[model samples]
Target: MQQLQILSGSWEQFAQDAKLIREQVFIQEQQIAAEDEWDSEDAVSLHFIAYDQGQAIATARLLENNSIGRVAVLKEYRGQGVGRVLMQSIIQLAQQQGRSFVKLSSQVHALPFYASLGFIAEGEEYLDCGIPHMDMRLCF
Candidate 1:
């Protein structure tokens, strides 16, 4: 496993690196449309990116409402714990900010991954961008 350096800041601080990973994972790999992949929320959210040996390997963002979204891990780095580490960083930041809870619309297939991180699924699964997803949250 390679050492991963996680950084968090506004979208402008890491838009290039973040977009690269998202495009590869969500657009190119998952076949999500370009319009559905990019959103104005990116400009207002706090973005997180994981760099392995200087290459962006994973990315996620936390919105003002304490909701997390846009999580993507490069195919080559998916099973290497890069996503776990990236999420831990975001969870820790939310705790530091005194947030009551952090929520997300998680892809149905990835439910187990988020559950392992203490997120609980709520409500029925729904389609978002043609993919099944469930609402999940982790209370502080």
Candidate 2:
């Protein structure tokens, strides 16, 4: 297996890998409702991407105030620790910026995954993109 490389970028200047993962995971496969997938907030957020031999394998975005979203790993790469590494990186970035909390809305199927990483479910499940989701948070 090829080693994965991670890069951090501002939304205004994300790399090809970042764009690729977003297109595949959010747009094509998940059909995340275009309206919910994008917002004016991206203009000031930080984006990260994991690349294996130059191919995008994972991605996530962390906005100011530590709100995390759009976290995804290609289906073929899911469960390989790629998502963990990406989340850890984003969490670290949040801390380095003096942020004390990070929050995310995770799909119901992925609740256990985030829970294992210390994100606690804080609200009732609701429909998102035709799938159930819940608000979650992790505070330092």
Candidate 3:
């Protein structure tokens, strides 16, 4: 595996790289519709992209509301701790910004992953883009 580097910036700075990762993970692998995956929030949200040897492999975004979303890791990179590191960076950024907490809509299957990071499940599972998800929050 190549050395992993995560870069955070505006949509314009990271859009191309972020979209490529999201397209592979969410659009092709998960079969999520393009319409459902892309959103207006992207333009205003802070984006994080994980790159390996300069190739984008994972992505996530932190919205102005202190909500995290659009987390995606390529199939080849799953279970490699890339996602965890990416999320940790986002959480730290939230703390640096003086946020009380950060919330996310975690896919049901990934609940344990987020839980291991200190996120607590908040409500009953619901379908988002046809996938089971539940709200989770991590307080600083």
Candidate 4:
């Protein structure tokens, strides 16, 4: 419930905070393998971080091809609009860049949440790092 500040920057700039959030949410909580959690794309992706009480509580990234990924929020902060805020920030950034569409592979459990933001689910569900997910897209 602390004041939330959302920031957009290069992965290099927010690497420590971003990685900490992802490590806690995806690796520690979700049991995702450390090897799968870290990736080479961070060097090139546009990153966003949500800070509450000066702590990085959530993080997401936008790829050059208009795909959003690595959306992670700390466990205690889930269901508090942090994820929506992060997604909206990415969507706004996409709009600013004149992107025609944005896409993501959303975990099945979070499908409804993404749907509420106007992202339509597509294709059959598949596993990503042992988690069921489906491709979702929102077209401008």
Candidate 5:
């Protein structure tokens, strides 16, 4: 068995693992600047890490206002359900916290994927950190 694990906690606790995945997917691979990739929000957000066979393969974060962001899955793991699992975990956590909605700014190319997960696109597409993105929301 691959023994996939989905762990959630403070950024401080899993910074190492989360950083590895995020830096690879966002910073290095996607050309996002290092400073833009690491932000102060991490200190306040809840982080989720997906590990496959003990190797970190995906990560995401949910903020206090139910804003979900920083979702990144290593290239090799895309389309394998890792991103879906991470989003579902975040949604379940928000519902457990009595939140009525969850929002995220998704990269333009990823809009369909988020939409498939029930998130609706709102407002016009705009640039964020040099990447075209759109604001999306899901209501519980």
Candidate 6:
């Protein structure tokens, strides 16, 4: 079973694993600019980390406006429902906050992935961190 825990009990684990995952996927794999990945908005963001077999395998962040971003699951754990757990948590948080919509910038290739989670594309595609992306919103 996967454990959905807030960024509390495992602060170090969260920071390390999240940094590692983001560093790999966003920074290295995707080549997102270093400064682009670290934003001032992180100060008030709510972060969720999922653990499987006692390891932090997935994570995502919820900004104050209910925007979901920086979602990632470890390479070895991809396609195993880890991203599903991360998105599931984000959706629940949006509902709890009485937020009407959840917005996210999805890499062009991952558009269908977000679509599967009920996020519809909005406007034309754009580029961020040198990668093609599109804005997606999910209404609650």
- Among these predictions, the greatest TM-score belongs to 1
Candidate 6 accuracy as TM-score: 0.87
lDDT of 4 by residue, 111-140 (tens): 999999999999999999989999999999
Assess the local accuracy of residue 126 in candidate 4 as a C-alpha lDDT between 0 and 100.
100
For model 6, the superposed segments whose C-alpha errors exceed 4 Å read: 1-13
Candidate 2 matches the true fold with a TM-score of 0.90
Which pairs in model 5 have colliding backbones? none
Compute each candidate's TM-score over C-alphas. Answer: 0.98, 0.90, 0.97, 0.97, 0.96, 0.87
Off by over 4 Å in 1: none
Across 4-120, the per-residue lDDT of candidate 6 in tens digits comes to: 453422333366777777888778877788888987765667777777866777778888786888888878888877788678777987798789999999989889989999999
What is candidate 3's lDDT per residue for 1-140, written digit by digit as tens?
66789899999999999899889989998899999999999999999999889888999999999999999999989989999999999999999999999999999999999999999999799999899999999999
lDDT of 5 by residue, 16-99 (tens): 988998888998888999988888999999999988988889999999878999999999999888898889888998899899
lDDT of each: 0.94, 0.85, 0.94, 0.92, 0.91, 0.78
TM-score of 3: 0.97
Looking at model 5, residue 132 earns an lDDT score of 99
Clash count, predicted structure 5: 0
Candidate 5 worst ten-residue window by lDDT: 1-10
Leading candidate by lDDT: 3
lDDT of 5 at 59: 93
Better of 3 and 4 by lDDT: 3
66-118 in candidate 2: lDDT tens per residue?
78988989989987889988898888878888888999999998999899989
Query: Could you tell me which 10 consecutive residues in candidate 3 have the lowest summed lDDT?
Result: 1-10
What CA RMSD would you report for each candidate? 0.7, 1.6, 0.8, 0.9, 1.2, 2.5
Q: Global CA lDDT of candidate 4, please?
A: 0.92
Q: After superposition, how far is residue 39 of candidate 4 from its true place, in Å?
A: 1.1
Backbone clash pairs for candidate 4 read none
